[model samples]
Target: MTSIFDADGKQVPCTVIEAGPCVVTQVKTLEKDGYTAVQLAYDEKKEKKTTAALAGHFKKAGTTPKRRLVEFRYFEEDKQQGETLTVELFNEGDFIDVVGTSKGKGFQGVVKRHNFSGVGGQTHGQHNRLRAPGSLGASSFPSRVFKGMRMAGRTGGDRVKIQNLRVVKVYPEQNVLVVSGSVPGAKGSYVIIEK
Candidate 1:
């Protein structure tokens, strides 16, 4: 492996990975389980919030209560028994897709959110109607406005997928994964990236 270094030959690009000592909360098999995937839970919290049933589920796996749990399409070849997956799972220059929730921009106009040309007028006495949608309803046919119309409603704060972001570096010791482009959500949001 080539040494990941910065301009001064210091390792800068290496991302800090906060991988667990995660617990195998649940295991899926082909027979009764009907699938082959392991549910891993990271960032454990107190037992109070977790129910006795769910707590016992984690207990059976030899792990404590966790805040978040996710299941992936697990294959036998990619399986590593009792080992944790960290930032070291990725190498430099690997292309990955990042998925996260985008920042919420509440009740945005068409021009801002949907990029519609709003009632085009800088000429004839344009007053306040600049950002308005011209005609929401057609006069004769289709009396009521169609459903799923792109009107001024809740914008952003949705699941966003950014494709082909180059993995610049991965610092397994620090537990961070830094990609080439911007990610969704705020500064400290959980994002899942896959190959």
Candidate 2:
């Protein structure tokens, strides 16, 4: 994440994303694959780390092995296999949706996960019950703690889609895009951008 100065001299917060020079690995057709979509590959990877089957797949595309492969449905343009896509696909002031995995906060309690107030005021022999999740349910009727109850459990590390982020800048030469607001995932993690 970084800050950029706009025309009015106001500092705007944004996230710089590598918009790719992604290779088109495959093109699915309605008759052949029962769907229409374009599969794109990004980021270079070592042959030693790539499986033989995947290596052959990349070889068919006339490109080296890529670390990430994503399929985009409903692509408007006519793109063939082995074609490269860059930041020129987007323009300044355009709104796009970014999808990525959020950071993992393993084993979080209700106080942080569900934003519970933590049993209210800490009084009346409430020593360590401040951050505890109050109660489950009735002890007898429908005993089994009812499904879909919000409680302490694993949190984060989920696929999150942030919609309608404006494109602040586009550097086609470097295949980079600067979008307004924060993006999910840690640094260097791959994100899928959709218009």
Candidate 3:
């Protein structure tokens, strides 16, 4: 994330994103595929590493194999097959939602995972029960721990959606987009921006 100076000399926090030179690999219509959508391909990949079926698909599109292919249902862009999309699709002040996988924090405890209060005071000769999760469940009533219990486990590395972020700037020459505030994923991870 970085800060940019707006026209009024106000500093705005924003996240820089490489907003695609995506190719329209396929266009699906209602009569043919039972829906209207466009499959866009991004990031180049070696042909030798691509599967035979995918190679044929890329050949049909008259483009090289790509690393990512995402389908946007009911896209209203009026784009045709084998066309390219860039940062020009968005403008400053446009609101969008960003979707990406968050950074992985690995295994975590209840105190860090669920904002649990560490077993209160340490007066009654308690040695190391400060961060314990107190109880599992009712002992005699249910006889088992309840489902969906908030306990210590994995943290982060989840698909996170950050909504309604304004487009602060667009550098179409460099295929970069600067959106207001921070976004999910690591520095080089790919993210989807939806209007």
Candidate 4:
């Protein structure tokens, strides 16, 4: 994230993104695929690293291999296979949504994950039960732990969508987008921006 100067010389925090010069690799139609969507390929990848089938797929689109491919269902603009799309699709002050994976926090405890207050009082000779999950299940009744329990396991690295972020700036020449506030994922991770 970085700060930018507004017209009033006020500094505004924003996230800079390389929007894209994405290529339309495939176009799915209602008749053929039972849906309408365009598969856009962004970033570059080596032909040797890509599978033969995928390489042929990129070849059919008249473009080199791409690192990421995403399909945008019901994209407002009409695009064809092998067409190039740039950041020009967005303009300053445009409201958009960004979808990306959040940073992984690995395995976390219930205190940090579920915000459970650890057995608060230390008066009754409590040992390390401070950060414990407290209880798992009832001893007899059901005889088992229930499903969908929010225990400490894996966290983060989930798909996150931040909506209604204003487009602060658009650099078509550089294919970059400066949006208000922060975005998901670690640095250099790919994100999908939608109108």
lDDT of 1: 0.71
Candidate 3 at 172: error in angstroms? 0.8
Model 3 RMSD vs true structure = 1.1
Better of 2 and 4 by TM-score: 2
Identify the leading candidate in terms of TM-score: 2
Candidate 3 clash pair list: none
Which residue segments of model 2 deviate by more than 4 Å? none
TM-score of each: 0.82, 0.96, 0.96, 0.95
Q: Which prediction has the highest lDDT against the true structure?
A: 2
Candidate 4 residue 17 C-alpha distance from true site, Å: 0.6
Every candidate's lDDT: 0.71, 0.95, 0.92, 0.93
Total clashing residue pairs per candidate? 9, 0, 0, 0
Write one digit per residue (lDDT tens) for candidate 4, span 35-125. 9999999999987899999999999999999999999998997898999999999989999999999999999999888888988887877
Clashing pairs in 1: 15-170, 15-171, 15-176, 16-174, 16-175, 16-176, 17-175, 17-176, 18-175
- Per-residue CA lDDT of model 3 for 61-83, tens digit only, reads 88999999998986866878888
Cα lDDT tens digits for candidate 1, 26-48: 66778968878877677768999
Ten consecutive residues with minimal summed lDDT in candidate 2? Answer: 119-128
Residue 139 in candidate 4, Cα distance off native in Å = 1.9
Model 3, poorest ten-residue lDDT window? 73-82
User: Which runs of model 4 end up more than 4 angstroms from their true locations?
Assistant: none
Better of 1 and 2 by TM-score: 2
